[model samples]
Target chain A: MPKVTRYDAPRVIDSGSIWILVAAPTIWAVHFLLSYWVAAVYCAKSGSGWLGGLTDPRWIIVGLGGLSIAAIVWLGMIAVRRYGGVFVVLEEITDSSEQGRERFIGHVALLLCALSAVAIVFTVIPGLVFDRC
Target chain B: MRRGTSILFGVLFLTALGGCDGRHNWMAGAGEEAAAIGDLFLILMVGAAVIWSLVVGAAVYAHRRRAHPGLEREARLFVIWGGVVFPVLLIGALLVWGLFLLKGITADEGDLTVRVDGERWWWRVTYETPTGDVVTANEIRLPQGRTALFRLTADDVIHAFWVPALGGKMDMVPGRETTLALTPKKLGNWGGLCAEFCGGAHALMRFDAVVMAPDAFETWLAREAETAQVAADDPGFQVFLDEGCGACHTIRGTQAAGPVGPDLTHLAGREKLGAGLYEMTPEHMARWITDTHAMKPDIDMPPYPHLSGPRLDTLVDFLMRLE
Candidate 1:
């Protein structure tokens, strides 16, 4: 039986998992277009819509893009803190199945946090702070 | 299992980061302004790194001891210090430091005046010489240990004239003159670069400040003032005139009256060609004239890509003999 330690325990950490953490916020940040598309679709489908007319689509996109950028940044920071710690733990933990699971969970959490931090910080915050382009 | 591979990757990343330091290394006596600014920037970065390392080390030690494992004390302290005191003090200090540096550049000097105009990719340096000759463009030959008052302006967009060894940067705004003064302390070929990003060829916008001894500078100036005597009334001279080089360039003694390009009165004497791309030589001059864009992409100087062979040689030879 392998010794249970945080470092070498369940090593499910790979670049793919890391990228999922990276891509979530990136997709969400750019999702403003979907909102506009939905709004337009609703107007066309139901023969109802004055909201899109009053507000320029340009402003709407810019606002959404800014928010997404902020969210991405926030997610990135969380990811950095979490991922940075997991790598540190890998050196110290004794390898055991149970410990491996814990380490794997921690890695996932860190990846999620980094993604969230980056998304929010880069996308959402800037949207709130600055005027819409 | 691939421990060595991970370590190698880490090492490679570190090496790449190390290379990001600007090419202006202080290993040897290079540009004066670059040396000063680079040394200061390095010192500040190293100091910050040391401080951060110490703080991290302390935090690690505290964490290992399980001192406030729940981080109650740290949380409260972070809210108080991180949220308020740290930002206020840090930002205040930075503001004060910036103002102090600004004062040094803007010190009152109402005597000396030299207009330095920034174009798309080169410095249009016009010096109001004592002999009333407003020497302009490319090479800036100044007597060592003399204060120069530069009125910096741009013909197009904003650009910065900075010689880190001599003094600070002055923004050259279109339709406005920014002022900066410097007294060169050493006598060597000092480098000056556009600190501002202008366009595609901004990186290549480099010039040299040749700080010669007072007597040597005088001799060079006197030699420059003489009308350029072409070594021969060669066909190359006719090629130069026929090529419409005269329309946009000025050769002091010849029919070349073009100010749209750099003054080529004393072309042979200059050390660098095409704004520091290549060393000034007969061969390089020909190569540059024949195909300027190939050597430096997006330079304002249009390439005569069509001209080649003897036509190129004669034109290059004629320009090189401007001494």
Candidate 2:
């Protein structure tokens, strides 16, 4: 019988863990579409009112955006702790080693997290400025 | 080859310059909102031009110059500073500024409300006053320096209401009402049209946005509210009824209570007829009645080809007298 190895390439990096790389951008896209649709529907149904009034649609958008940012931050933490992602420096992981591929994914995920956070902030701007429809 | 290219560019530039004389020019800055937007556009255009020149210049310099292996850190720094940092800062600033301008232009309410219903190829305008609603068609008159809130809605299909000299376009969707506010600062007949293509004769769908003094506007609105004063047994009135013109047109204080077409109570008082397609003249009116398709193809109004000679003349005379 052959002896079992201590590391077996981490089971091809697991399909489920790949989602961590794209979680931030996916959350951003969802938040953007949801915010726009909600505002349009609400404006069409009910006319313009005072800011922070009863019929204001900004509250829902802000709430969802906050929750999405929190989730992305959690994913970023996982990437840093387990996948060896560095915040300041981008790692060159072009080698064929399994550890290199994992670190590459983590680095890309970290960058995407920052980009998605910026996009989420941008998405919330229209609500902050426009008090009415 | 370079000389030929230069000549071609010159011709193109001249053509573009000539095209600026169009009646629907938004850069005229005839209204407060339009002027605000125009100023913002000019600033953005200058900024964009500067940025584009810098980027292209840098690209050309990089491509032509000899590369050194020792300058890797310099190149990376340049990419970070020029490509990433500059673009982020510029775009972020622009976004905030644009949002601020948008907030400034948009108003919750105005001094007066004018409900404009977008039809397939025409506008059904109604002025809501403290007394009552004054119904009109194809023309909008406002007082200079006073804001007018336009409550826009479409009956059949989607259309966009645009008075370029006045302000930006607003979509008129069916089953929903969209509002836009305009404060005209100039006294002129600015062209208004349906920006969104609906169906046939969409291009012919136009209106005259006339800005006047406050007193003049008040007088005109009051006069427009009054009913037409015509003899009951007039030959022209008989011809109008016989030709079924009353079925689709309304003449105030008369039995002609049709809701399909425009109200003809103040037809002669209008600056243009056929929805701003022609100057309001008796000759054009006669041609419009007989050769409706020739004037505006695929219009809802049928041509009165059979009614010629005295009958056509009488009908035209009656419509002309509807001031």
Candidate 3:
């Protein structure tokens, strides 16, 4: 009778998963730049004094910020589920296993999501406070 | 070695402290808007100093102190509180406060309106009065306790109008108009300069922002509205017309309407000549007429090197009497 051997190898991490780590921060950056650009261009093109109204651009900015935060929160939820439904910051997830690497990425993605949410909130403050162009 | 390093740092700190003189100081608080901005700057500076001290202290401790393996929880908490929570709260508050201040200062209208055009190496100023537009150059006079709205534009390239003691800077863009509102609270002469680098002679572009009392400002504006009172048959007037000086400069109530250079309507009444670069005197005026490049390099005014003797003196005298 021939001896039977079991083959075991670490699963390869998919490149598609890496985008989850940067998705939220990228949204935050895009939203910040877009808000500033819209305000600046509008003010420059419209000339001095009230053209349409300050509230028009303010509402647009608020909507953009809200959408960005919602996307970040959704990403955070996905990260939590993929990270074994636990948030770990004090311990390093370095077991030389594929599962451990995925957990590490998930934890980092969740942290980024939280940071992006805070940035989105900061971006919305200008729209709320300034009532003029 | 540590003692030497400490001494060096102390000297550097003292040197930095010496740079807090009031010239070009944004925190001079000479105006209402400037005072508001100064208050905000003071708060931000103090907060930044405290935050810097804490961050540097923690960094030093982390570098020198021995690691405690069991203090992971404390480390995580420190990151969350100091790195995450503190920054978010502080920056969010500051952003809101700054935006509110901006809105307050940029009021839509003011008591008076002044149009300032940024030229190559000077400022073309026009004050809208109840009678008519009183045109002047290189000098801005505002009444104390009254808000003045500045409608700024550039004739050539981009320039920035800044009177550090008054308020924030506003850019003068070509083909577009930008406005700034400021109310002078203190009565004094504040320095004004072009804060943007618009090629040659940008550094020489400057003006004097004089804050005067309301009655005095009214009197000055009244005087500025009248035409030049020089006699038509004056020899100096003849000399001014003969030298083709009228081709570039405009003197009100006379035929010297060229529109190529600053309006010399109220030249003698101004505090300085050559765009606030020199005291308005006969000598400097003569030099400016004879050697324009030496006074303000790259200016459009051609030097009258060929015209000398009593004629040059007469031209200078004619310009000085433009008040």
Predicted structure with the largest lDDT when compared to the true one: 2
Each prediction's TM-score versus the true structure: 0.58, 0.91, 0.87
Q: Which stretches of candidate 1 lie over 4 Å from their true place?
A: A1-133, B1-23, B26-43, B66-91, B106-113, B164-167, B183-187, B230-235, B299-312
For candidate 3, what is the recovered fraction of reference interface contacts? 0.71
Model 3, B13-94: lDDT tens digits are: 9998776545456677899999999999889899889989999999999999999979889999889888878887878778
Q: What would the C-alpha RMSD of candidate 2 be, to one decimal place?
A: 3.8
Q: Which of 2 and 3 is the better model by DockQ?
A: 3
Best TM-score goes to which candidate?
2
Candidate 3: which stretches are off by over 4 Å?
A: A1-16, A44-55, A82-85, A88-91, A131-133, B1-19, B62-66
Candidate that would win on DockQ: 3
Q: Any idea what lDDT model 2 has?
A: 0.86
Which has the better DockQ: candidate 1, or candidate 3?
Answer: 3
RMSD of each candidate relative to the true structure: 15.2, 3.8, 5.6
By lDDT, rank the candidates, best first: 2, 3, 1
Measured against the true two-chain complex, the DockQ scores of the candidates, in the order shown, are 0.02, 0.45, 0.52
Tens digits of per-residue lDDT for model 2 on B61-166?
9899998878777777788778877887888888998888766555658989999999878899999999999999999999999999999999999999999998
Reference-based lDDT, residue B256, model 2: 86
Name the 10 consecutive residues with the lowest summed lDDT in model 3 chain A: A7-16
Pairs that clash in candidate 2? none
Off by over 4 Å in 2: A1-16, A44-55, A89-96
